[model samples]
Every structure is written in C-alpha cells, then in structure tokens.
Target: MADDQSLITILEDSREIRDLLTETLQHEGFDTLSFARATEFERNMRGLKPDVCIIDLGLPDRDGLSVVNTVASNSGAAVLIISGRSNTQDKIVGLELGADDYITKPFEIAEVVARVKALLRRKAPKAEATLSKIVRFNGWTADLEQHLLTSDDGKVERLSFAEGQVLRVFLSKPNRLITRDQILDDLSNGESDNFDRTIDVRISRLRAKLHDDPNNPKVIKTIYGAGYIFIAQVG
Candidate 1:
C-alpha cells in the first residue's frame, strides 16, 4: 500500500515472536515495523497507519483483544490475531471482535505468512471497496462494496491489488482485445523502463483468482504476444 510493498505493523512483546514475524514478513516482500507494547504501538500505528497489523493477544500491559479492537476501531489496518491461545473459543471471540485472521500458538511461519497475504488481498480497494460497485463475469461475482467475491457456490476468496487492477481493466473494456503494450503502458503509467513481467505475472494471478484454466481459458484469452481478450458476458 505504501509504494510497492504493503506496510505491516507487528505488535508483540516477545522477542522470539517478534523476530519470527519480522523474518516471515520481510521474506514475503513487506515493509514492517515492530513495537514492544500497546503504548508504543498506539503511537506508531496511529501515525503510520499500516495496511495490516499482526498483533499478539498476550501483551504485557494490555489485553490483546483490546489492542485488536483499538487498532480496528481507530485505524485503517486490518487486525490479525496471532496468539498462544489455541482454543476454538479464543479464535471465535477474536473473529467476533474484528480480527481478520486468528492463528494459534506453535503455528508455522509459512501459515502466518499465508494468512497475512490473504488479509492483504482482502484489503485491496479496487476489488473489495470501491468504484464500479460490482463486476459480473461468467459465473463469478465480485462485489466492491462488500469486499467479497463468490464463484457460484464456492467460498468467497479475496483479490489482491494486482488481480483487482487486471480485472478492473478487463471489466472496463469487455469483449475487446487489449493490447499487451497498452496494458503495460497503463499498468506502468508509461514510466517503466524497457519492459517488465509484472503485468504478465499479475494476469496469471488474476486468471487463477477467476479459476480460469490457462490451458483452456474461458474468461481471459491470451493473444499470443499481442494482448488479451475478455470473453465473458460482462455486465
């Protein structure tokens, strides 16, 4: 959200937990900031306003749930409950209290990273929060207002920033062949030097979100070094 990497605030008093989280997050290409306690976090998080907050439920001086509530209640960051609590009740309560994701103790770093990525995906404004309101393609549904996506009866999956951008472009120009060069120019705002694979990677990722088989694509058809065509019945 800030520049290219999303800003993440990790609030945990334990040095081990803090180190593990920072390692996992930095490996996933995130810009991270850490705090020792609620007081320290309150000042930094409010001022920085990261897109995501990975918070431990066992702070030294404050209730972790209260921190989650405060962050969610006051700031824009999506709060994730990362704690030693393993009971189902703890998880349920965390979710009820506005936690986007809750992980138990002894969790794998990869799992934490995955959950963070998913939360980040759900935070994308283009796919989840504004403009156009909705995009209807084939049997898939994208609701910007609610930040939800439903593929027929399947569970709702969140869209990342790049996926949202690629889909938004197609939704804006339905049934039309969009030139690769045009897409590159638009995605990079013509400021990219030479060429980059970012657009291609994003398109692939978008197709995955739509559940479109790259081998026998239904929604987006690649034009073989040219561009792409959105063949769905858009509305």
Candidate 2:
C-alpha cells in the first residue's frame, strides 16, 4: 500500500480473464489498464509507466517473453507472467528472462491480487533496510545502487535482487550477529517464517560470490547454533 493508486498494466488476450483481473485489481484499490496485444502495451508505455505489468504469453502480436525481456532491460517496472502454460521449463524461462513471478492459468483472482501486492512490496524501498549507495568492507566494495560487487583486485561480481537484499541486510549491521529469523522477516515482509533453509542457501550463495571460504570465512561468519555475523567493518 505504499501508493494506493499504483497503476497496473494487464496484457492478457483473453477478454474474460482480462475483465476478471481488472475487476479484482480495482477491488483491491489498484488502477489498471488492459491490453490484448503487446504492441498496444509497448506503445502506451511511452506515455504511462506502470508500477507492475501482468503479461500473458499467448499474445496476438508477439511472444510475451520478448516483452518481458524488453521491459526488464529498459524499465524498472515489476513484471509478472500469468499464462496457461504450466510446464516447469516455461516458468523457468520466464523467470530467467526477468519476470518477477509466474502464475499458471485457472488461477484464483485472490491469488493474483496477492502476488501483485507481494511484487509491489519487493519493488518498494525500505528506508531502514537500505545502506549507503556504496559500502566498502575489507577491500570489497558493494555498490547497492548498481547491484555489483567489486573486489580489491577489480574483479566484479553481479548480484541478483535477492543477493543484493541479503547483502544490504548484512551491511546494515556490520559485525553484528543477525538471526535467520531476522533476515527472513526483513525480506519476506513478515509474511513467512519457515525460511531456515532458504536463508542458509542465500548465505552460501553470497559467500561464494564474495569469495569467502565456508570453513574459515573472513567476511561473513556463521555463529553455529545461533545466526550469522558479518565480519566486515563497513564504512
């Protein structure tokens, strides 16, 4: 609810589905614009930038994946694909191309609304969770704005949105023990709790990107039986 009147663009060819989605989103206090073709959506995007765009693959003009790639590359809008294709491969392709979330057809309108809200929450800026645009720790610089990490030797590592968020949480409380629950709560907007494994996985991935050895890490240290401690001195 950061912006109660946040605009949402819907790009589904099915008239019935489009009407239902427009009604459901409007009921949730969102402003919506529906399009049956990708060309129309792209044309209007020049005039109006939406907070979130719901795209379907079965477009009359072009493949929706192309739209997802183009929008992600050019704009900061959150993209969600609602499609009838339920294949896991198709979903993966959509996500890999930068769609925030994917929902297969025959979905509940309530779930669609919930997913849109969740995506918006991710896009919204959390003032407290943010760090300086750039933070340096032990010869490594994390450019939070660019989502890139530069090592002392000038080796650059790219960060996914989730990775950047986890790194921000660590940098916000440098050298402090941060519980898994705290990390999960911060990232999940307090809507989830069973994230022990998820947190571990993200931490492991971050460590790998930071080149921190698991056995004797210098940056992020695991406090066995408690939580993680960012060993870096943030500046």
Candidate 3:
C-alpha cells in the first residue's frame, strides 16, 4: 500500500475509548493520531500529513462532519466516517463529501479493524494495508515523532505516558486482533488477580465516555469466547 507504515488519525473525544482504540491500532502496526475537538483537528490537518482519517461525527465543541470537509479540502488522506448516526442520508453526505467509507453506530470491533486494513490497502494491497510509517484515519492527525495529537484548528492534545504507550501498541500493528488477556497483561504491568476485572471496567467506562453502546457496541466489540477488538471502521 502506501508503505506499510501509514499514519492514521483518530478524532475522538473520550480518553478511555481513545486509549483502547489507540492500543489496538498500534498493535497491528500503523501510526496513529488522536484528537477531541474541531480546532485541534483543523490545526493538525494543516500541519501534519496523514494517510487515513477516522472521524467521529459527535464532538463536544463542533460537529465532526465539518472537520471531514475541511480535511478533505486540505489533505489527500483517505477519510473514513465513524459516527453514532446510522442514517442513510448521513452516510451519503459524508461519502459525497469525500469520505471513503461510513461506519454506523454499534458496530463490531473486528469490523472496524477490517475497514482500516481496507483503507490502508487503497494505496496498494499487500495483505497488510502496508502503512507508510504513518496512518491517517479521520480528519484528525497525529505526529508520532513529536508524540502529539492535533487538529486543523492548531489545538493539540499531548498524550500522557500510559496513553502514549497504549497508542503505540495499537498503531504499531493494524488489523491485528487484541485479546483481553493481552490487554490485562499489558495494562496490569504483569500484576493481575482473580478479581482483576479492571480491563472490563475500563472498557465499560470508555464505551460510555466514547458514546459507544454497551448493548450494541460500536468502537469496541466483545469476541464472545475470546476478548475484544477495536472496530476502528466498518466496511
């Protein structure tokens, strides 16, 4: 594809879901950027270059569709709409605005990863989507070397130690599945117990904060007998 190291930006508002998705994306080997507002998203689009963008239509400060339009006008990155809205008109408008795909609410996490791989594959298919050292998911952007997540408005979200660590793992690998065992092990730093339902608890909080439905689930999916997956996109 682009280079097997494409940079993908995640324009989401929730820190908990952000951490989980970032971890999962990094695990499969792709660069990642994360943001929470329109200002930051616009700023980053002007400054940084991303390959694919996953825009969350719901934002506290502004509607994410505006960011998508702005990014499409300014950058050549592939655009993917990640929205809680499942209306046909919304999807048509987003795609007409230049989004490559539209993912509805309450989607499976595995499906998200699959869409990411497909988006990355647009550059060229080699089975891995072949990230070119960076990944652009939505209109939002991230600069791995600088370790900063920014938007088109110039606002920046500096990641913390743990957040960055989690982001790194997800961006490092794209489309690769992650399990709860792996999540708990990584998050616990090796210290876990019988009552260590910390991972599930964190995921639940994240789902709420990210506006993901627990019953239907959008951004993350339970693997039934396995664990969970980050559904960063839908086909």
Candidate 4:
C-alpha cells in the first residue's frame, strides 16, 4: 500500500488503460487522476503536484516525450513512460529524455505497481548518516534537497530525479572507480539486462549537464571495460 499522501497522475489516451490504472492504483491506496489528453494533464499537474506521472507516448493532443521532458525539467515528480513502442531505441530515448522508468504496452498492472513503489522508495527521504544538503564540486554547487545545480558562472539548472540520484552517487565517492552495478545497487533500482546501456545513457545526460565533453571527458572518465571514475576533487 502506498502512503495516503502519495498521488499518481495517469496520462493515457486509451480509456481502458486509463481507467484500469486508476482503479488499480486507487485500490492500492494511492490517489490518482487520469487524463486522456496531454493538455489537461499538463495544466492540472502544475497544481496537483503528484509524486509520480505515468505517461503514454501516443497522445491525441501532443507528443508524450515532449510532456516527459517538460515534467522532468519543471517538476520533482518521477516520470514513468508507458508506451506501445517496445523497441530498445524507444526505451533508451525515453530514459535519455528524463524518464525514470519505462514500460511497454500489454504490461501487467502488478509490474506497474511494483515500478511505482520502487520509484517512491527512491524518492523517499533517507534516514541514514547525516550529510550536507549542499555540495560543491568542480565549480558547481548542488542543492540536493531542491535538485538544483548552480554553475560558477551563475547559471542554474534543474536536475530530474533520476539525474539527481546519479549525481549523488558520483559525488559520494569522488576520484574513485564506481561500477555500473554499484550504481544500480546504490540507487536500489531493480536488476535489468539493459543495466549497462541504461547507466551509460544516464551518465551521458549528466555529463552534458555538467558541461563535460563526451569525446574527451575530464570529470567522469570511463574505464574501457570495468567502470567509471570521478576525477574531480569534490569539496
């Protein structure tokens, strides 16, 4: 059962899917709002402040990926892409564009619930050792609580929940080699066969945000076959 305060917004055009998800999630103790069009979803989301947004790629009003990007950039909600496009490329693209997770058509409702639970777990505040909420590294300041990054030049960038998690992993162990498996373990993201590719795409996006050149990266150096090392001296 989800927390009473946890709200889930479902944006799917299919009435069957939309209603099914709403019924199932609501039955599981989650508050849900279903939308058939991207326009209404976008408008209501600004005020609802849901904890998770389940989006379908095929929408009548606008591209679902565009909605994913917008939500990721502007909100702290976890973005889950539920689409009929099952190709590897589509999943990769969705993750690259800021989705926290992906599910294809004909997916089991149980899996959806599990995925949502996992995302919520990751979003939940940790009660472990105390750490600073603000971290400075490589001429950048990260406000972990707000998921905002400020560059030395005064430009501020908002980080998606997924990006913020990846960044936290790197910052926690600077100048140390961190394997992809270690990253997944630290993130508490369930095991998947596409783990490598998923981590690579996330790292690539984080690098771009940090202004690190992919061709010749300085901060995060990829080890040919082992893992990656954060070279910057983090403070």
Candidate 5:
C-alpha cells in the first residue's frame, strides 16, 4: 500500500483496463485519474502533475510513445508503459524514449501496484547527509531535487527519473569504475536481461544531455570488458 496519497494518472484506452487500474490504485490509497484518450490527458496533465503516469501504447488520439517522451522530457513524473506488445524492441524503444518501467499486458494487478511503489521509492528524496540537492561537475549544474540539468551556457534540460538516477550514481563516484551490476543494484532495478540494456540506454541519454559525444566520450568512458568510469571532477 502507498504510504502517502500519491497522484497517478492512467491513459489506457481499454475501458475495462482503465477502470480496473483506477479502482485498484485508488483502493491501494493512491489518487488516480483515468483517461481513454491521449488528448484529454494532455489537456489536464499540466494541471494534475501526476507523480506517476500509466500509459498504454495503443491510444485513440496519439501515439503513446510520443506521450511518454513528452512527459519524460517536460515533467518530473515517472512513466510506466503498459502495453500488449511484449516484444523486446518495444520495451527497448519505450525505455529509450524515457519511460522508467515497462509492463506487458496480461500483467497481474499486484505487480502493477508493486511497480508503482518502486517508482515512488526512486522518486522520493533521500537524506541531505547522503546527497546534496544541487551538484556541479564539468561546468554543469544538476538540481537533483528538481531533476533539472543546467549547462554552463545557461541552458536548462529536464531529466527523466531514470536519467537522474544514473547521473546520481556517476556523480557520487567520480573517477571511479562503476559496474552495470552496481548501478542496477543501487537503482534497485530488477535483475533481468532487459535491465542490462536499460543501463546502456540511460547512459546514452545522459551523455546526450551532457553533450558528451558517444564516439569519443570524455565524461563517461566505457571500458571494453569492465564497466564505465566518470572522469569529470565533481563538486
């Protein structure tokens, strides 16, 4: 059960699925708003500012992946993609586009509840002693509390929850080699083959935000067989 009354928005087109999710989440102590179309959700998104968004791929108004990308880039909310497409490519595409988690259709409601809780845990703020609200490195500033990244040129970029989590790991251990396993462990992301690929996609996304060229990356260098190392001086 959710500890607090976190707001959740469901964008599933199926009436049964939407109602089921809304009722289950509400019963679990979460405030939920269900929408059958993407346009309706988008119109109220800015106002609602849900903590988590449960989106389905097949929507009547717009592509769900596009919606996920917009939400991930614009809002601090975590995205969970629920679709009937169980293929690996779909999952990868969803994560690459900034979704935090992907759940295939025919999923257990309990699993949905658990995944929601996990996302909330990741979004929750940690103790001040462990992490500063703002961190700077290589002339870039990261507001961890706000999940905002500001460049030396005064440009600001919003980071998805997954990207922010990866950045936190690297910033916390600069000039040190951090294995993928360690990252997954710190993130508490499930141990699965898909999650391994998830780390790579997240790092790729973070590098883009940092303006780090993937061909010859300077900030985050990938060791052939080992892992990755953050070489920048963080403060």
Candidate 6:
C-alpha cells in the first residue's frame, strides 16, 4: 500500500499466517502484497518486482521450490523460503537453487523479522555498500553484485552464490583472520550443513579462482590453527 516503502511480497495459504506476516512487515515500514496461491504470486510478480519475496513451500497451486527457482533466476528480489520442512537436504536444495535464506515454519515472528531485515541488508545497495560491489586485489576484481571475478587480462570468472557470500565476508573484514567457525556462522543462513570441511572446500575453491598458489598463497593466507585472512587491500 505504501508505494515509497520497500516492497515485500508474501506468499502463504493460511489466512492467519499471511495476515500476520503482512501486518508485521507493514509495521516494519515495508510495503507488502499478500498472495494466497502460487499462481497469483507468479502472475502479479511479473508486473511488480518486490525488494524481497517470502515464499512458503506449502502452496496449494504449485510446488514452492519451482516458484523459488523461477524467482531466483528471473527476479532481482531476494528470496527467503519459509517452510515446515526442516530437513538439511531440503534447505540445501533451496539454497543451491538460488534461495537466499531458508527458515522453518512455526518460527518466532521476531526471528522472521530479523531474517527479513538481514536479507534486505544484503540486497539494499548504498554508497558504502557499493564499495563492496567491486573489490580489487592482486590483479583480480570481485564484483559482488554481478557475482563475477575479472582478471587483469580480461578473463571473467562467474562466482556461485556461496562463493559470492564468502567473498563478501572477506571483503567486509579485510586483513583480519576469519575463522572457519566465523564463516560458517556468517553464512549459516545459506549453508544447510554446518561443517568445517565445507568452509575449507569453499575457501580452497575461492583461492583457486583467484589463481593463488596452493603451496604458498598470499592473497588468502591460512593462519595455521586460527583461520584464513584476506591479505589484500580492499578498496
């Protein structure tokens, strides 16, 4: 209803839950559109792209995951899946398919609000945030918004969602040792499994993309028993 506010679209079949979410988001200064069916959401979303889309997996018309995949690919709106499915595999599938965050149902309203704000923080681009959009170091450029890295020689490398998240964390705390636990915690919303080895693999992949030598990497240095540090000047 509020045109000037950040638009948030909520898709839930339950009237009570839908109303509650719409009311909560409106109270939080977000303009919201509520849809009781996936088809309604799909059709309306074509004309009005919201800043965020809160999707419930139990839609009556269509599979919510399909909707999530579609929205993730077609819309710039951040997707947050709210489903009763708490299985790790389900969450992982949602994330891998491009959902930004996933939360189980019967969740605390406060937590929902918190996660919503967090997603908005990640999506909303400010001047200070723009500094993070393009990070250059060691002849490689990381574009957070575009999710691509460009080398000085004009070679472009596309980054996965998880990779982009990792790069963002590193850019935010440049020159500081970021522990594996910290990375897991920072990326907990996206990562379904909280395993240390997962972070190690991701870091290894990122280093490879940066062309850092595995034997003696300089850009992302492993701190023995502590963590990894982004040893580059991020401007």
Least accurate 10 contiguous residues by lDDT in model 3: 189-198
TM-score of 6: 0.62
Clashes of each: 0, 0, 57, 0, 0, 0
lDDT of each: 0.71, 0.80, 0.61, 0.86, 0.87, 0.79
TM-score of every candidate: 0.54, 0.64, 0.51, 0.88, 0.92, 0.62
> What lDDT does candidate 3 reach at residue 194?
19
lDDT, candidate 3, 114-135, per-residue tens:
7877655543323543333344
Off by over 4 Å in 5: 125-129, 189-193
Q: How far off is residue 86 in model 6, in Å? A: 3.4
Model 2 spans > 4 angstroms off: 130-235
Please give the ranking of all candidate structures by TM-score, highest first, separated by commas: 5, 4, 2, 6, 1, 3
Q: Best by lDDT, which number?
A: 5
Error of 6 at 209 (Å): 8.1
Clashing pairs in 1: none
TM-score top scorer: 5
The per-residue C-alpha lDDT of model 5 at residue 230 equals 95
Residue pairs with backbone overlap in model 6: none
Report the Cα RMSD per candidate.
12.6, 5.2, 17.8, 2.2, 1.9, 5.3
**Candidate 1 lDDT tens digits, 1-235:** 2234688889999998898888778877888999879989887664685878898998998999988866654554667778899887787666555565677788898888777776666455434333466877788888644435688888776654335555666776778899987765544444322224346655776787778898999889998877899887876
Error of 1 at 125 (Å): 3.9
What is candidate 4's lDDT per residue for 76-173, written digit by digit as tens? Answer: 78888999999999888887778888999999999999989888988775677245679899999998767889999999988887788888888888
